[model samples]
Target: MNGVHAENLGARKAKATRWGTAFLVATAISVLFLVILVLSIVSQSFGYVLVISEVDTASLARNGVALESQEAPALIETLKEGLTRRHLATLEEAKPLESRNREELLSLVMMEIVQERPARTWTLVQSVFQRKAIFDFRDSDFPDGRLYFRSWLRASLLANPQSSSALDSGLRGAAIGSLATILLTLLIAFPLGVAAAIWLEEYAADNAVNRFIQLNIYNLSGVPSIIYGMLGLAVFVRYLEPLTSGVLFGAAEKGAASGRTILSASLTLALLVLPVIIINSQEALRAIPQSLRKAGLALGATKWQTIWHHVLPASADRILTGTVLAISRALGETAPLVVVGASTFLTIDPVSPFSRFTTLPIQIYQWTSRPQGEFKNLAAAAILVLLVLLLTLNATAIILRNRFSARRRTNT
Candidate 1:
């Protein structure tokens, strides 16, 4: 009997050892792939490009000092002199050209007037190791072209607006549209989802109808996002066009369509994330100890009062963990927004919730689908911007979660 017992214990120990080794290997593989992805994105974001403006850059220079070195006012004057009246008016309509800073005006001058475009490009690795070879090839093959070390990721990418030329394009419009859409989605979805979760976790009786609803909620979370886009197209865009388009409120702008505004897009995203929030919130609420409720009841607190004051505060951090996940998913979603009518080539910023919109994901998609190497570089830079924005939002949520955890600890 002693020998058999010892053998059983040894077998259990061997199994545990195998499982631990497997888990460690899995974790190592995940980290390795993550590092590889980061390296690949960084490789595309910095390099050397052969830039050749159609017009000689020095011809536009102020007293041979260079056009790029000019002041804002001078650059604006140059734009006025070089651009057509219609083109000038289009630029002014977005923002008063005079109000733009020096660098922006310079970009405009280079893009619109000089027509500077990337003629050829090389990756950072090639640019560094094959410097002599690249220069020799450039001089022999295309003497008119000039070489410059260009970092695709730059301050200008964030500050400037979208453009027909990849060199002049920026993510300002898409970023602003993303912020507006995501914030509004949270406002519309968070409360409703939490309320549904509370009902399901605290009040709903286990019955056929309730079980059906629970099953549907779980299933909805896994549905393709594009389905929500179709639902929004039918309901918000077509059926309730007047409301979503702001026609009912008499707030529609000159060119507002039946729908397809940020409001419609946000509503679609809200539906897409609703199940995720509810499931997470329900789990959070469930984790709170039953004794807390009993204690509240013993103190003569009503069920509603206990839930609002005690139960919710205890689970706030966990609930916010779900919110962070939903927000991250919404930030990177492209197909739903595309199907819901996100403008693919928009330059002007959305002025209101009822305005047409786009997002970082959409911009990245469009840029990547193009045939140019420069556009691919731009796409890589946009991915970095999206990652930074996601991290910033997640950091903010984490701080709030920590505060809630601290407050809950103090209360207990």
Candidate 2:
């Protein structure tokens, strides 16, 4: 009997070792892929561009003098010389070109008068390794164009709005739309999901109706997001146009009757992530030991009181963890928002939930689908922004969850 037990113990140890090795190998592979993905994205977010102007700066420079070295008055005169009367009027409409400082005037001269555009581009890797070759190519093929390094990802990109020109475009509107959508999605979904879970887990009887509801929620959680988008189209956009479009509140845009608004998109995403939230919240509630509830009741506390005071606090961290997952999905979702009428090129920031909106993911998709190489680089930069936003949101939730767990432990 002792010999047989020793052999069995050895076999179990071997199995455990295999499983441990497999787990480590899987984790390493996941981390490796994630690093590679991030590196690949960063690679495309910056590079060198041959920015040639329609009116070459070389000519504007006069006898090999750099245009940039010229005084503000000279630059202003250059602009007056180069720009049309209509162009001068348009520039004056924004700000008096005569009153503008040197730097501003210089930029205006290059971008507006000179009409500097990306003549050719090179990736960061190529820009670094083939620096001489790239310079030679630019000198030979596009001698008039200036070769300069440009980082697509810029702080200005966050502040500026989308534009027809890729150089002038930014993710400000999309980022705002995304922030508003996620905030609304969390507001609408979290309470409803937690309430539903609380009722199902704590109050509902063990019967077919409840079981069916639970099973359906699990199934719904796995449904394609696009289906939810279609559902939103039919239900929110079409049937309940007044509310989603904010007409019910006496606020509506010109085409809001179609119900394609930020509120509608948020509602659609809320619906998309609702089941996941419900199921995960239910799981969290289920994991709470019955003894806590029984002890609270045994101390003469009401059922609602017991749950509000004890059960919820016990499961708060896990509920929040699940919420992180749900919101992550919501933040990254594009299809549903597209179906619900997200504008691809919204230049202005969303004024309200009723206004037209677009998210980073939609912006990325639109830019990526374009034929322009610069837009592709912009798309890559947007992807990085989206990833950072998602990570920041997730980290905030995790920090909150950790604090809850710590407080609960300290209280105990």
Candidate 3:
């Protein structure tokens, strides 16, 4: 009997060890997958492209006169002299060189004067592993073309406006629009969500009506975000057109007839994230010690004063964590904004809440839909930018949370 019992116990221990190993293997696999995904995106964002120019740089830089050293007027003259009449006319029609500053003229000289266009592109892996193949292919197919490895995510890519051409396109307008929309969303959602959470968790009676309201809030958090977009379209875009379009404020631009603007998008995203913020904040408020609230009331403080001075300060960090989650969800959301009429091809930055706009997600979707290979690389680069923006926003929120937490500790 002792021998049989000992063998059974040994078998059970071996089984438990197998399960632990399996769990660790699963976690490692998940981490490996994430690493591969990020590396793939980075690889696509940098590489070698076979670029051919309408005019050679060496030809333009003859007589020891480099194009970069020239003044605005001289750069304009050089551009005109180097570029064909048709190309020069196109550049002038796009934006007058005469009105542009020295920096702008220099960029135009490099871009338009040289007229660089990608003939063929290679991913980072191909550029690094098959450098000889890339150069040979460029030399054989297009002798005039140059094979250069370039990082697509340059400062100019963030500075310049969107263009039809992949080489000339940038994220300035989309980035600005994203920031404006997110700011508006936060302004609208955070206070309202937090206030609702405080009332529900601290002040509201545990009655049937309040319980029903809590249930609905939980349900809303699970509803599809695109449904919120549709709701925003029906309400903010149509019913509140005059308000959202800035017509009521007398700030509407001429010919800007539609209510499909950044304000509507922001409001739509706010609605989408409101339930998340409220639920998370309720949990945070509930997490505060009941003893602290009792102590404030024991000191002859009213319920409102107790909450404002004690409970809120204690729960500020967790409340900010909810805000961070809400912002993250809103940042990556494209469907709701799309339904509320985000532009896929906006070139101009949004001047106000009522202006037409596009976010980075919309920009990435637009680029990925294109047939061009280069645009896919651009889309990958845009994804990286979107990730960076989300991280920056979360980092800022975390810093604020930590500051409040420190203050609370010092006060206590």
Number of the top candidate by TM-score? 1
Q: For residues 96-178, could you state the per-residue lDDT of candidate 1 as single tens digits?
A: 89888877788889889999898888877788898999899789987988888889899889887888888889999999999
TM-score of 1: 0.94
Q: What TM-score do all the candidates reach, one by one?
A: 0.94, 0.86, 0.90
lDDT of 3 by residue, 305-352 (tens): 999988888898989987987988898999998998988997677899
- Candidate 2 lDDT tens digits, 89-110: 9778756888887866787777
> Best to worst by TM-score, what's the order?
1, 3, 2
lDDT of 2 at 307: 97
Model 3 ranges off by over 4 Å: 1-16, 55-69, 77-99, 109-114
The 10 consecutive residues of candidate 3 with the worst lDDT sum are 251-260
Clash counts for all predictions: 0, 0, 0
* TM-score of candidate 2 versus the correct structure, residues matched by position: 0.86
